[model samples]
Target: MALPITDHIVAAVSKMVDDSQVEGYREPSHSDIEFYVSRAGLTDADPKAQGQTVGKAKRVRAILSWAIDNDQTAGGKLVESLIAKVRASGGFRDSSANFIGADVIARAVEAFDSEGYILSSDGALRPKNLESLMGRELTVALRDYARRAQKGSEDAALLSGTSKDLLEATAAHVIRTKYGSYPQQANFPALLGQAFIALEMATPEDPPSSTESPYRVMERGMYQSAVGVNRLRNKEGSGHGRPWVASLGVVEAEAAIELAGVIAGYMLDKLDNR
Candidate 1:
């Protein structure tokens, strides 16, 4: 399914595209438009020949619309680029020549926030959808782990630990939702199995039969991956107080984080759908 693009984002981009009538508005040059179009990898027609305000707005809308329908990631990147440009320009001025940069920024920020992203101070975008899917507390912990893991001194152990926490939190959320509370003393695999059981979905223990559906096969694989994430955390993660550091690099750590995110998202999605 195609991911959503908010109306506010489209409006904000349209405003930036043709704000010449505004009192202190600085119109983007032809080169500027071309640059943006090129950066977004849009290849419909010449942006310059797209005509005046109305025509330009239509072109922008069409590009964004097509992007969302065809490739949602590209669509998201395009929106991110537009928002960054608007922020960089400090926004356009109103008819009274009042600086309304803050208002524009607020609208853009709010739009992204609703979509589960944090536009950081340095303009870097980070996903925070877990907050909405799981809860704010779990999301907060995940974000902290992400931030620490991505620091200049990247800690593989910490990243590994975060991956485990990601699944733990997800499983805990599922079990708690179904049974009022999860077993605190349960091990990682047990907790994860309980989550799948609570959701009435297949777990790692569910053996593949000749007549098993493809979905069950996929579910079994996913459960195994969750267990693997836990195993990695136990061996290389920070909580063990290991005497020697594991021979894991940033790339491995990043992969672990990404894997954890995908699994967690899948689990949470199942929870929501069920």
Candidate 2:
């Protein structure tokens, strides 16, 4: 099945190309078209001759359409790369036409924003669907942290800190849903345990005998993983005056974030069922 490449995204790219022609700005060259097509892992299905500018735009559209029809993940990546390229080039503006680029970027941002994603300050595309599962305040906070954590150039300290904050906000949201508020005085692991208990999931606090069930064991393991995440956060994460740990890297930070997300999602699932 074709992936859901929204019309808004497709139109944004096509419009940018078309608009670039008005100002006589450089359009994507033949090699550029070939590169993008190959990048998306798509074969050019439309080869009809047309005006230079319009032809390039049409070829881009054709390539993107073919990508959507054939490859799900690559299609999204292709769109993201195109948007990033335009954004990096400061929009589709000529030397005398500053507004063009801004206009194109705004349209692209709006298109992606509508699809539960955000264009970060550096123009990186990141997921922003926490609103469906959390309050606006928490969702915004988590989204910001997640974006920073996921950025290609983020430092290990920031990634570690943001990953920890993501879990903390998630736990707070789950706890707030069950009770009226979260315990501000609780430690990270304790707060995580409270969130699990609030959702009636197995926490480390559960008796050893009761944790023997496979599901319970898995939940307990999740709780332990969260604790480990907290430990990493304390040792290497930001928000402290501690010295930077050279050993912590992107891979470890990403793993921590993914683990936190998994545990948070599991707890939220329980909260939803309740």
Candidate 3:
């Protein structure tokens, strides 16, 4: 299948840095695109090569895919992060009129807020999705979470709560897909724990060890994250009138979100052929 956001990322990445706060910010050019694409391994030819052969769509897809899988890719930061940078830098302008600058990027992210795709953690270009691997009900719930907990929002508790809930919904969907039954009435962590068992990811009594498979390690981490998320949900999450007593932040909530996504993606992939 064609990769997400490839059609628009190049345009988004083409603008000059508009950080009014910082002097000497450089505007991006076709040269920057060429360099980034080549460095991302999306193109074999040097940036100084002849007429361009790799289309922007192809380059964007490859760069985003590399960024998702590798941590050190160039400028693969989340679109939101880029937006924040632009906003901090006083925002960029584009003569293209159809630009992908800060204002446009913000709108794009907001437009996709209730959809299946989201900006990844680093403010990179990939449009992340859970709907393809999950059901409509689960994805809708996740979309709600994504909208509320979006970056730059001050609702950290809501972010943690929504992420925890998203993890639960993912488990429910995966369990149904794997075992042909929906788990009803179970708490979030319990439902996830049972899903892990059904997948043979780990046993209930097992402790972390050096010998476990990577899948097992992932399951262990997901379960532990759920525990912390649930605790944060009760203590600091929305829907509670209690005074805030915890230290939940965007970073922690974002970590839970990323972890939930990784676990869900692994589980869904395992069920792909079955």
Q: What do the candidate models score in CA lDDT, each in turn? A: 0.58, 0.60, 0.48
The candidate, 1 or 2, that scores higher on lDDT is 2
Model 1 lDDT per residue over 58-152, tens place: 66666676665665566665666655565455443333232334555456557667766554433334454433344545544444444433352
Model 3: per-residue Cα lDDT over 47-106, one tens digit each: 235444554434444455445445333434333344444334334334433234556556
Query: Stretches of candidate 2 above 4 Å error?
Result: 1-164, 210-212, 234-245
lDDT tens readout by residue for model 2, 1-274 = 1124676777766665554356555444456555665666664443432233346577667656665566657777667666556555555444534234556668877987787665644455555543344454454445445445444223312322233355676787878777877887788888888888887788767776843678988988988887877677654434444322456676776677666666655665576578
Model 2: clashing residue pairs? Answer: none
Number of the top TM-score candidate: 2
Error of 3 at 229 (Å): 2.4
- What's each prediction's TM-score? 0.44, 0.46, 0.41
**Greater-lDDT candidate between 2 and 3:** 2
Please tell me which model should have the higher lDDT, number 1 or number 3: 1
When 1 and 2 are scored with TM-score, the better candidate is 2
> Of the pair 2 and 3, which is ahead by TM-score?
2
Worst 10 residues of 1 by lDDT: 152-161
lDDT order of candidates, best first? Answer: 2, 1, 3
lDDT of 3 at 133: 42
lDDT for 162 in candidate 1 is: 34
